[model samples]
Target: MAELSADAAWNYVYCQGWNRDLQRFVGLLDSDTACARNEAGEQYSVTLLRGGVPRVVIDIAWSAHYLGVWTLDEALRRDSHVDYRRLRAEQLFPVRERVWRYAEGQRDGDDDVWEQEVSRKANGWMSTSKRPRGRLGGSSRTAGQEDDTDIWREVPVFGDWRWALPDKEAGPVGTAAEHTGEYEAVSAGSPWRPPTPYRNLYLDDLMLEGATVLMEGAQPRVVAHRLRGMVDMPTGQVITCEPRWLDYSEPFTDTIEPGRYEVHDVLLTDPDSESDWWPRAGFLLRVSEAPVVSWEMALRAGEDPRTLSDGDFYGFSGSQGCFVDAEPLRTADHQINADRGREQSYALRKWARMAKRGELHEHPHSQWSDALERGLDDRDGIRLPGTNFNMIAYNCYYPDGSYPTWIGRATDGAIVCFLTDMRTTHPVIATDH
Candidate 1:
């Protein structure tokens, strides 16, 4: 037998039959040697070599169960072909026959049969559906199944040294006092709070000067377009998305009182610069003027904000721009489609007029000119010439991407605003020094 290293021996003796152990064993073998591996990188079979000759073959079934050692010929016989019917006969058929027998005994009529069928189907569906996989430590039972103690008994390492294992205990894994200066203690009964302070920025403070626009048949002159609108949210549930892509949006679960909410577009214009494009900074949907005391991610119905992991956030998709409105607007699917068609037709007609005037020169500097030509007046909302909609729409900082929306709350717990951060420019926080 080849001498094993300390790590190799410890793993072979103490962690035998584990996927990692199998992988380590295969890694040490010659690369030309054949080995069977599952999709999960779990090695199931490998031939042991002595002087580059096959000595014995080790094999493990699914999940590393039923590990067996065999001679070269025996391993060859086992690998030659599969006997699926024999497997089903030995494993599945007996359990299924027992279940059928039990059902037949309980059967009273077609109704009983129907109930059994329904129950079986429901169980099958539930078993196959995606669910969060959690580990149960020690000798705990899972989902009414047998205690894991019995399952661990089959493991080679556990079989011989089960009594040496320490008893499970319940307590905090570590204490703040143990690392006094490294940790901060929070109140036990208080509501959960964010780790960092959220910035309370004023929309008016974000204004810039000397922004210029080049109108058709006119000189490039300085112009400032501040787009602001009030959106009615009768359903309380707020939704933001590209107005035309309302179908792709979901409502925020943290709803406010049903009422009209003010939506303001944050534009960044530099008077000193020569760029014609007055890029948008972001959009703010104000719910109250009260100073915001807390901020949370605006999650949808199915999402649990409390369970959000790092890098997880609720993002609104924007193509041309974004809209802020109530969830009730989503019910008018047909009207939305009609309005979209009308907007497309209007854009086509405007383009034709621009072409007729021989003013079709490519304006590669900015999409603002294209939006202006399409009759999207920078007034209350970016409403096309003819289409009517309740949502407040405005161009985002960049043309398209996913943007995160945050919900701010006042000291008294009332919602203050919903901020869609486009990440182009940072607004001056009122409380910042």
Candidate 2:
């Protein structure tokens, strides 16, 4: 059993399209190789059986291309004995092309037929000498530097854990033999007692180590969502301009970090309105040079939260948890208006220091957290793209103890909302005065 280090640079693959049902990337096909190798081309699907039952079946071709598996040996010079460079070079589809093919494949509901088509294309290319090359061409140098800036923005802090593990005993937060749902419920005790700061909360479950299933025969759903606030390359725009999904239900709820919220659980507009729309959350940047602090160590050090950096620490009140905003608890204009009050500001300031205090907590709610934002519901909430899960956005409490309203989509994964008071409604639904 080899452990891919927590900092492994290339653990993700860019797929054809986002899978609405599975909440993962639908791997783009390598039709060229499928045609060239015949039975050997089936190297993409490597099935491992347990007691003759297919316990694990991973797509090796997809893994090699997406996770930079081919470059690992040449660049890192570590996994030298094995090579997947050939398969990586054979990936011919770009994001748009892949999206269309995957969409058609799903719409027709014919996986085998699509596979055959891909194989046929590859075979035809051999005779015509017209093989398609992906946006990242054939050179190993170009392949190594494939357009990952967008990929990184889409997923900054990825780990091996599933969004929600099926087994209650081996859950993300605990491994008790007979588990109690303490983490799931709002605590009856003081909300200030946050969950213990963890180091790689997803690493405990060994199954999360690879794109494949764990040794225990558990095939969990992959927990893959783009980080919010990513800058879209072509548009030269930050991704926050678009709305995303937020789910606060059972399966998704199980995945939430104790003091954090995911994009799927939030909504920007009221779903029941006649004209349904989703809007992206707003962000305000207030830069500070204060040293970062971690929550676990800060608690032990007995340091004042007010003295810590903005947007650094986390605190809990009963079952609710929130990270302090980088800015003081002021309205968007940065005014210390008495109307917004003081306790919330103090709370926000205290939580902001957790990052520098030596706690192994995620620095969410900031642009620096990841190439894209995932765990940020604080800086006007992070915007996650292409999610299918939904949540009722009637009104949920912000970590600052304020209840904000959200709007949701019925079919797709888009949500929009306003954090503070605002009068402008959705333009599509707004009646002419």
Candidate 3:
């Protein structure tokens, strides 16, 4: 390909559907990846691809509604060896025809790339391929020796640990053992007591040494959910862990960190509704950036049916009365006007900062904090498109201490995303819920 000419340097702006304020605002909203997420109940089911590393699982309370999203909140990457890069491919189907550029140290180059277009029709499958030219065909990797799934993480100041996420812990905050069922109720009047401003709430980044987890055993029936950090407030330390599930009721709740912990549970919920529709990870995660925070986890199978997707973070387990959302759940009251008073971009940042400031020490209402417009937890929410576990959710809180919620919605309406195959609509009944 020869270099282009200056005459062909066509440059101009083209506007197609543009007219009034409604359309303009709608357009703005469309570009918002944030909105695509947290659209509660628009779709149900999140699937981690067959190659999803580490583990996959999430849990949202079935009774929650209004605003809930499959949130991929809070991620940070520190400089390290084994130079790595993350590519966010925006496409209708990146398996073949993609929407954007090939990221990550160039998954490929100008060199020939193999193109296999597969389709399903009736009881048969179809595949059209554009084989690579000469040596550009298959990679040098051998059978079963494909991609390397290794990661590293470093702690961040004010950042809490998150096990579920592939990142390191940031701060020292973890839930207490046993379901107190009183995180929200306790000191809802004025229960804030943050660390002193002089405290070393450094915004420094610690380097994460790369490590490996060798599973040397008969691979047990695996069930992995994202992890939340554990912090012993008494000692001001943070730790990240990946806890395994034993049974339904008494799953292992090991504290990687010692000492007593005060439960400051951060959930992915709507800002204004009674409760979120999804099963939030009960006890996990750390505070980040003083203002924002994140919560991670999924899955809780029920005995009624074993219909759980890979990384089913919010589904219930055991033989109890299990319920699934029949249709895409929807909810209002994600972030109220009061929450977004006018200044804050996200509500979580304000809430976290205030919490650290001891604002809620006496009463939640007294320490009530609100933001102008933003989420309670400010972290990049993870999302997997086209796959079954393609979920997106986020939330914000009202300083006035109302039942916090999120601005959430799902793209896969009633679709069940899981391993094995692609998306399959798994409609759940709201009545049972």
Candidate 4:
């Protein structure tokens, strides 16, 4: 075994159980009475005891990016007094007024309708709540943000921000074909196993053969569609979007070269119910010709990807299909609003045409209405007037959920592409070397 550094030894003692080497290391501090004990719970605690009394405690919680140290008194007080429910309630109290204003406008004085609308909106907000977990604390202080309170001083972990030991040997990294056998074997008995006649789509295949044109009523277990326009990455910063939405989308902190890239939409054709449409499985934005050899989560500025919990993602909000584009979608507010107005007008015109042609009633009970709301013309892609940016939208899996984007890199660490994982099909094996 290699000799551990002081920080490594300390982390080993707190994260793993104490061994002879760790015990000897701890002896240097105070051999007589100093000892450490691990107490695992929803939050793992490592208590440092002196004369059988807890003096210091180290805590590591699920999804927490750092290890926290607290005095025994501080830990006891927090554990006994902090009420997450009360905190959550306080946090959401201010949202009621805003929700009411919007709901009231839509309700038109119907108390039941108003209440129901409020409840629905409130519940939706609660479901996607980004409240901090594990401990009661303020956010880290930034230029315009409040400073974090000194409840528990945080310490960064040594290796990966995941706070776990690094893998001894790196996993294999290659194209989809090289890993398909392993993926099939692992997914054979899993819930996410692909159905019979399933086909896995790839960027190379799509670019070479063009999108698989679907006939009306034709359903393939898996399919891919080429987004009709090129994405402009003028500043290299990228953001995802649901083309139909007029809202501004936030960009990921990381960037690629300032250039244009091709976009592709991947989807699962079979829906959970007959009324629903095919939902998004993932997206591919080819950034370079280099083959991807590894992947990492695409996070916003100052956000650490390793701290994200399972099922958690860092992507744009979606109600319809989503696309990728460069930041500063429009240069001026007037231009942005004008583009939005045009989309709205286009949608209204299309709906009117469909209604006049008797096409609206064809899928009356189906979720195809959602697609109509996005405008039929935007099904392939949409380029804003007087702008180089283009949006390639597609239906989201079931219409809504937070999807995560992964940065695919070449063996030499150059970015090859970006993938927005909607189905959670990819394996977690990428390592930082």
Best by TM-score: 4
Q: Provide backbone clash counts, one per model.
A: 1, 39, 113, 1
Q: What is the TM-score of each candidate against the true structure?
A: 0.40, 0.17, 0.16, 0.46
* lDDT of residue 148 for candidate 3: 23
Arrange candidates by lDDT, highest first: which order? 1, 4, 2, 3
lDDT of 3 at 87: 19
Highest lDDT model number: 1
Badly placed stretches (over 4 Å) of model 3 are: 1-239, 245-259, 271-433
In model 3, how large is the Cα lDDT of residue 171?
25
Which 10-residue window in model 2 sums to the lowest lDDT? 248-257
Distance from true location, Cα of 44 in model 3, Å: 42
Model 3: weakest 10-residue lDDT segment is 199-208
Model 4 Cα lDDT, one tens digit per residue, 1-433: 1112222212222222111211211111111111221112123333333322233334443222323333323122211111011112112111111111212233222332211111112122321111122123332221222222322222333222222212331222111111111111121111111011111223223223234423224443445454634666778777765554445566777788887777766554433357444444577788887766676777776454333323345566676554454554544223434424548788567667877897865432222235335543364455543465555555566457656677778899988877776643332212211
Ranked by TM-score, top first: 4, 1, 2, 3
Model 1 lDDT per residue over 12-75, tens place = 1111121221122222222222223332323344333222222233443333223333332211
Tell me the tens digit of each residue's lDDT in model 2 across 256-327: 111223222212333245644333221111112222121111121222222222122322222122222211
Residue runs of model 1 more than 4 Å from their true location after superposition: 1-227, 269-277, 305-312, 338-389, 426-433
lDDT of 3 at 415: 13
